[model samples]
Target: LLQERQLIYDFMYKHKKTYSVGKICKYLKVSRNSYYHWKSVKLAKKKDSRRTVLVNEIKRIFKNSRQTYGSPRIQAELEKLGYKISRAYVARLIKAENIRFKPKKRFVNTTYSKHDYKIEKNTLDRQFKVEQLGKVWVSDITYIRVNDKWIYLTTMIDLADRQVVGWSLSKDMTYENTVLKAWNTARKRRQIIH
Candidate 1:
């Protein structure tokens, strides 16, 4: 149907100056009003095509950013690419495309609070202010991801001067490998005066 309409419209366009529009529509067995309406809708579709192009560009930028950019950053990138798009419009487009940004992982919790093991009492009782050099020591274990594997890091710090007394890195989170290794290093570095 569209192809036939297009052919009739093209024929009318090519001979518009030579022939009348009513005579052409009558001979083509189509209404003049339908041709006029299709012409107007075709003009409107040109604007819609521009929007489609912008949507494609936005999707490309979003993917290139690893889907980690929000509207403000996306708008900045678009501006750098010579696209003068507003942040709100970019946000709307992102929402429409269902693009979700993944937040950077800052801290990974390795502690299991619901464990069945015994919980140690807080001996220091939040009194971090230590006067003597070897009065108090604090230790913590953290995990780091490298090459799709998690490695454990244990660090022992002297609370008095806030200095790292010892540290250990292990492929596993075993107590002997992590805490004991760091503790041994600290004992070797300085005497256990406390």
Candidate 2:
């Protein structure tokens, strides 16, 4: 990502009359700190990487904080070490070094069970027995994680046989993708209607 910033800066430099660093940075979502960092890196080609020292300091502070400190807290620790640094720079360092902390699980309720819509009563009356194979089918929906994204799964199972009659997997849980498809497939397969 930083290398792309350099390439953009080089282009902006050649077209100085048409573009400024601020405009380029805004357009490319590149921070001014990164621009200055690239500049310092270029000017100090004769010397060793300056950020290597800062990176090491950041690592020490981060480790001392039990890896729970974000950029703001890390910057405070750096200040104690006589290094005046920006939190954004600290964030860049942490991102570049792949420093991370495990986040606690957060529960997000996705159900709308208490809404004002008309809800059906328990017609089955908690009874699981069904005389016919295709007469009574129960369905449920759930979401699965796939590469940081959620995909929904809906399954319809015959209560009498306790076997899955039909299933549908989709990226969303809308009616078209969720219970509708599964119900349609099960109905067609069983050739039965309620």
Candidate 3:
């Protein structure tokens, strides 16, 4: 409805010199009072001095934060600067100004290939699909933060069924706790007929 009003306003504005206001309003089926009201509101917004200042300040704060500050943080900063603004309003302004923030990536390096232990050969030759259960198994280890401490998780999956045959969680990444424990659990759960 607002868009239709805007289109009507634009059409009337463009053709105002050639056509009278009453005729245009009657043809468009809109009241002249509503058109005048919308024109007044738009002009008042354009004449607002605070909008320009706020946009500049918002851009400065966003740049100072290295483009990492989101709407909530930006709102807090604006409040600190004696401007009481809502987070939603700040977000809307940011979107209108085409401001974007970079998202922080959560990644942990769990694998360290440089070690004294012998590296095993790839026996599967990259062929992951298996014809039968227990024929091919894969394992992976990852870590999760728990209570400000890291807990390692190990999982063993059977390729045929694509199910987690065994899993283990430990505070340390030791072989006996992670890989060995998961392997022991897998052996107990499913028989390997090699």
Candidate 4:
């Protein structure tokens, strides 16, 4: 029992990232039945530690502020009280405590693809090359599936060496947002052009 508990702790300490019960069992070289039994035993034996107390206090402050205090702010506040804690520790505590700050949930589309603004013709026209640097550029938007959520990423690439010049990420996929990213990337790279 002690060995199994130590194995579970070691596995979690080493992995850091989330793991499934099956993964835990596989990593610890134990059967699923044994892993679950040990997990329940360990959970039952668990007691509130000093870290838990500090985290609870942090959560109280976060909640009292209406969930506006993120990790950095919370860490700063704790430091003011003479608590020597790292931002990473605060972030992990927040996640473990399931304390979430209110995130900006409004999805605003700033892209005006249907507007009357002049559209620049595709200068590269699939000829993705340049004799000199920054002559041709290509950009695209892609979405990543993180858990059950979708994260949108827009990136501009220089055709000269297929290098990423700029990138932006958001929870919303807007045409204007993508175009602006590409334009900004080109503007920044203007000095690099021949």
Question: Judged by TM-score, which candidate is best?
Answer: 1
Tell me the lDDT of candidate 2: 0.83
TM-score of 2: 0.49
**Candidate 2: worst 10 consecutive residues by lDDT?**
41-50
Candidate 1 Cα deviation (angstroms), residue 89: 6.7
Top candidate on lDDT is: 3
Off by over 4 Å in 2: 1-98, 102-104
Compared with the true structure, what per-residue lDDT tens digits does model 2 show for residues 161-194? Answer: 8989888999987999999999988988888887
Question: What TM-scores do the predictions have?
Answer: 0.49, 0.49, 0.46, 0.34
Off by over 4 Å in 1: 1-66, 70-72, 80-82, 87-110, 114-116, 143-151
Which of candidates 1 and 4 is the stronger one according to lDDT?
1
Tens-place lDDT per residue, model 4, 139-173, is 77777867559887888777777778877777776
lDDT of 3 by residue, 6-57 (tens): 9999888778899999999998899999989978887788756677888898
Error of 3 at 119 (Å): 2.8
lDDT-better candidate, 2 vs 4: 2
Tell me which residue pairs clash in candidate 4: 111-176
Candidate 1, residues 1-194: lDDT per residue as tens digits? Answer: 77877988988877989999899889888888987887788778986897788788888887887777788988998899898889999888888878889876677565679988998998999999988877787999887868558998999999989999989999998899999999899888877765
Candidate 3 vs. true structure, TM-score: 0.46
